[model samples]
Target: MQQQRSLQAFISRPLLVPALLFVLAVGLRLVYVFVTSTQNFLEGDAGRYFTMVEQLLTDQIYGYGSEKSNARVTPGFPLFAYSIYSIFPFTPNVFRWVHILIGAATVFPVYSYVSSVSRPLLGWLAGLFVAVYPPFIYMTNLFLTETLFIFLLTLFFASWQWMMNKPSVWSVILNAAVLSWAILTRPGMLPILMIAVLFLLFTRPARRLLIPYLLTVGVCFLPWTLRNWIILDEFTLLASDSGNALLSGAYPFFQENPDYKEMYSLGMSQTQYGVRVILKGFKEHFLQYLSWFSFGKLYYMFKSMWVSSTLNFPQLYMYGGVLLHYLTLLLSLISVPYLLIKKNFLAFAFTGMLLFQLLFIPTARYGAPFILLMVLLICSAAYTFWINRSRKPNYKLPAGSAS
Candidate 1:
């Protein structure tokens, strides 16, 4: 058929080999690092995360000796760390390796996601972007839950697409599992699951499947809530730290250089102090929330560009990289209209989720949802250009004759 020949020509183009090489080059660079950087400990988050897990196993409390309730942080990640600490190697070195190993699962899902949209090849770029992405690797090596979150989220995302293609009980159950797990990791994720469920309710095929989806999600959360209530003397659903998050986001406005440590020195318990800050922001500094939507996310995403540069080091090259990162992100924002016109519902929804999190907490870490926004946009551009080139007729050739 004409379509089959066209598809073949697209795949066999002169640049196909180079594009494949670019992806492989990126993967090999990231994959071989475990052997190369054997001594590099987790650069961030991994330290605090593992320490919390250590407390859970030995101190019989999540925070161990610290007066601060670990519940102020999300619980799912520490629980995962402890689970791994119990059965697997307890050394930080082994933990780093484990995180790296587990992160490998992201490759397949990222590939499948791009394939679902239009082309399987685009998935390579997306997945490779995640692998070499420095923050993700750093998060994994330490005690953070981003990798597990990504893995779980990819399943939920893929399931969402699958259900769109063919609504079935199996897809609903799969989505529920992924959603519940994602919720456990990032509290913000509960909203995302709600959106997905709502999407199902509104869609033609999934509307009938809402009840079963709800029941499955309920089953997942009940056990965790019950455990917390029995052991922690709280009727907490997952963790008891929303008050602290609210405070952390708000307290910076009351002072020039507000620090979490200052709250402790001032004798405010973590949860108590944090709650007051959140309330204070709402009552007095409500404008910060709106300001953050426009500038805070822009600033944080601006900073996230540079993996090495900081206000501390300020290396010229690193600073340059940092600026480049946000510049690309800004381009992504402009392309939103183009994507929307193309009916890229999945990318739009994903960006919407990030937008929600940014509204509440606009930090570089919180901006993780925009993982490959720039890369995908550029790759899609390349593919579009290639397809256009492939469609051009040979004007110099004889009419009605093949080139």
Candidate 2:
């Protein structure tokens, strides 16, 4: 009896479950890395990132191919790669090991946010879901911004929630700093800062700290902006990739029509050309464009794990991931009404972020970082269901009274 009580106490300890989840997350990512280590883990944008890092080290430039400096991509991931290569030998696998640690660490914010608002069991489940989620595990073995960006993004959400609850100056500053880091990692995150600002403006207790938050974020971004001004000879804010992204997104299913390609080749600036193409497409095919930008993008973004085709995985793992993703999606759908009825500000912020992503081309890679939010929503719904079920009156038929 004493042993049973002790075991229950140990299990119920506040930190034990999250710690276990963290260990589980790390173990799974490590296993993935080891299993896929022999495979070609570097593909797609990994090459460009490596090239940028090489330029950063050798020539102190930030662009590809050594001729000139351009802000094709944000400096965050390149800088991160630079730091890693500076200390360790420049190898993709070396970065994979680091990413494994980072990918696993993301579990903390998910656990913290969910557990703070709901039961600890829900928090543990959310953390476990992320820990075992295939895309999160798979991305760690590849050289991409997803692992680091997702970590900062989740941390930002947790910090934002903390500020909303307590409304402290320090929390606001922390939130801003995390968000600034996220923006550096992915320029698409800029709109989230705007959403956060609007959130603060409407939130009474946090209204006063808005200036500090903005100032902190501005201060964080100032150096990068200045770098663009001095080095690239333009007053770019985050990155110069947006124009190309817009062009890519302008096409239905990202399948560019030949006429659109010809128009782009005709010498307009990328931004102007992309805007023209998008406006022209909308004018010509309003319904088609609308459907592509809305449900089509959402479907592609959340459809599958964005793992590299080069990496080898057991077939069972892939199938399990698909099943888990659909399960989370279904649960999130159920939670949406709950979030709306509760007026959950975080839900609003997340929705704004998703809507903003629709302005660009979205894929599973883009959606991978936000999976934890889905898991959080799932947990919230599960907790609500559990609580409602627990509270129901349990009246049994009196002895033989039931007809």
Candidate 3:
């Protein structure tokens, strides 16, 4: 009864708004998961990812090169997929189920961290936002490494901040591991390179803390990098996929079966031809990149974060989430000063997170939508939670307490 009473007391604390919001987030996400991922596993990236993992285990093929019969993601997804696959060998659907569970579980850490910054209600609101967002929910059904990578990224970031506030070697090591794992899964982080490392090294009074973090993550990456070098022959730091993706995104000719007005290479399929033509096309289309990074593009990209994929397609309509995104971004903007003045470095760190996504995978595919949506979700939750506290009236003064 004592522990139960204590728990109830904790729950009843004035900030239970976040708690309620968290539950709502979970409920929304659960509905999404059931709608999308359950019993229906089909083609596209999700199927490709699951099959790639099955290939890794059944055949010795590490890199699923585009040789008419294979597919490729960064090594991280397939390797992690294999781990998930081993547990439920009978069905790829099992991993799909696991993806939904893991993706749904992301709400907790996301809520807790954002909640820590402001209120538990804010955390819950953030969680609720994530719970319902389609980009997150859509990805949950596939075997993408992004699912695990993001969850750990959120977890490590929260823990890293907690450790920085409190200071501990274990926290440092865990942060390093999480980030390194993120890098290993998707080498796009290789572009951002050492932001996290530099943060650990030079940001603190206890400069000694940097040693364990760098050393731990370094130890982890050494073998991984060495293995890459041995296999891919170049100074392969992480994966061998980005070159192909960049080629595909930069030029329209790289589509699955091009117009064939211009053949870039002989004996190469449409995909391979695109990858081969990427460099030349980039040189020719250099102006397109400038347009991509322009103020207009950035604004549109940021705005797109809140809008539904359905908006682009016109077949599916759900605009309520879009309204929620607008509110979210406004609140997040409000919190910017708080994060800066209050020494919430995660706010700044998250800027780098956005930048990392921007610099590498600027495409509007599954990767690009994540950035704006995340901001919108976090901000909207803050606004909703904030309004409830400020505007809502309560008259529950205790026995001896004065209003």
Candidate 4:
């Protein structure tokens, strides 16, 4: 009896819960990694990133080839992977394990964010959801930006949530640094950060801290921009992938296959070609595309669960991810009323990012980061419902209301 009581006491420590969650998260990621590591194969952007890392290590350049430099993809992930490979031997397996740790570490931010505003139960739920989240787990084994981008995004928002209330210069600088790294990892985050700037300006405490935040994010781009100009002779800010991404979205063939031709080949720059293709496609199929494929794109962003062709798991693996994603979306919708009541416009930053992808080229992989925020909102709503239920007065009905 004494041992049982002591065990309970040990388990009930304030730090034990998150620590256990972190351990469980890491364990689950390792299980998935072990199961799928044999099937690890790089293709498309994954292949590009792999080559970029090699180039980074050998030539000290951030591109694909020995002689020429390409800025199509941002250097953040490659740079990060290169830094890792620098310390360790060059092995993709080791890199994947590092990513597994990264994906697992995201639980910390999720727990921190949820605990800041809601009950510990909700925090545990958020952490657990992220721990076993199928998409997050799967992305770790593949060499892609999604895993790192998701981790940075969760950390950024976790800090942003607290900074909104505290408004410390240090916090602003930290989040701005995270935001810059996020953009470097996935350039799509640039516009999302812009939306954040606007959202912060409206908040009382955050408004006073906007200048340093904006300046930090702005300055973070200069070094990359300079690199782009010196190497590619292009005044690129985030990356050269933006125009290609837009082109891919506008190209109808891109739906079925990634190898699509540029419809507009008038020697336009990447930016010009992207704009021309999108405008041209919209001019031809404005209503039909907008009414049908646009919604389809949005649905794909939220619903599809494309892990990898090499996944040897059962069909349930894919379907399970879709089911959880759909359920979370529903919960997020249900939570909207609560968010509105609380006047938490931080949601705008996430929604704007989602809508931006929906408008252009959204994939299941791209939606991974958004799921972190969705998990928080869903757990928050669940906790709110639980609290209200517990608080409901146990009023006795008059004599015979409904015996």
lDDT of 1 at 259: 61
Task: Write the residue-wise lDDT of candidate 4 on 106-169 in tens digits.
Answer: 8888888888778766788788888776777778778888889988888887888777767788
Per-residue CA lDDT of model 2 for 1-403, tens digit only, reads: 9999998999788878888888888888887788654544667677777777877888887885344788777777888889889899887778888888898888889888888778877777888887888778878877789899988988987887788888887887899988998899987788788888887789787789889998999998998899999877899887776776676777888676435556657877666777887788799999998999899899989887777652456778778878888887787887867875766766666677788788777888888766677777767666767777899999888887956
Which residue pairs collide in model 3, if any?
18-120, 18-121, 328-379, 328-380
Say what the RMSD of model 3 is: 7.9
lDDT of 4: 0.74
Question: Per-residue lDDT tens digits of candidate 3, residues 275-345?
Answer: 55555555777666555434323454456542224533123325655565566556666655555454445
- Candidate 1 lDDT by residue in tens digits, 158-272: 6777867877888888878778878888876766766666677677766888898899989988877776677666777766656544455553422443466878788886567
Model 2 vs. true fold: TM: 0.90
TM-score for each predicted model, relative to the true structure: 0.72, 0.90, 0.72, 0.86
Alpha-carbon lDDT of model 3:
0.58
Candidate 1: which stretches are off by over 4 Å?
1-45, 58-70, 251-289, 306-328, 338-348, 359-361, 373-403
lDDT of each: 0.62, 0.80, 0.58, 0.74
Name the regions of candidate 2 deviating beyond 4 angstroms.
37-39, 64-66, 255-261, 264-266, 309-311, 384-403
Query: Which parts of model 3 are misplaced by more than 4 Å?
Result: 1-30, 33-42, 66-73, 190-193, 249-289, 296-317, 330-344, 364-403
Ranking by lDDT: 2, 4, 1, 3
Cα distance off (Å), candidate 4, residue 15: 3.4
Which residue pairs clash in candidate 1?
46-142, 46-143, 306-322
Q: Give the top-scoring candidate (TM-score).
A: 2
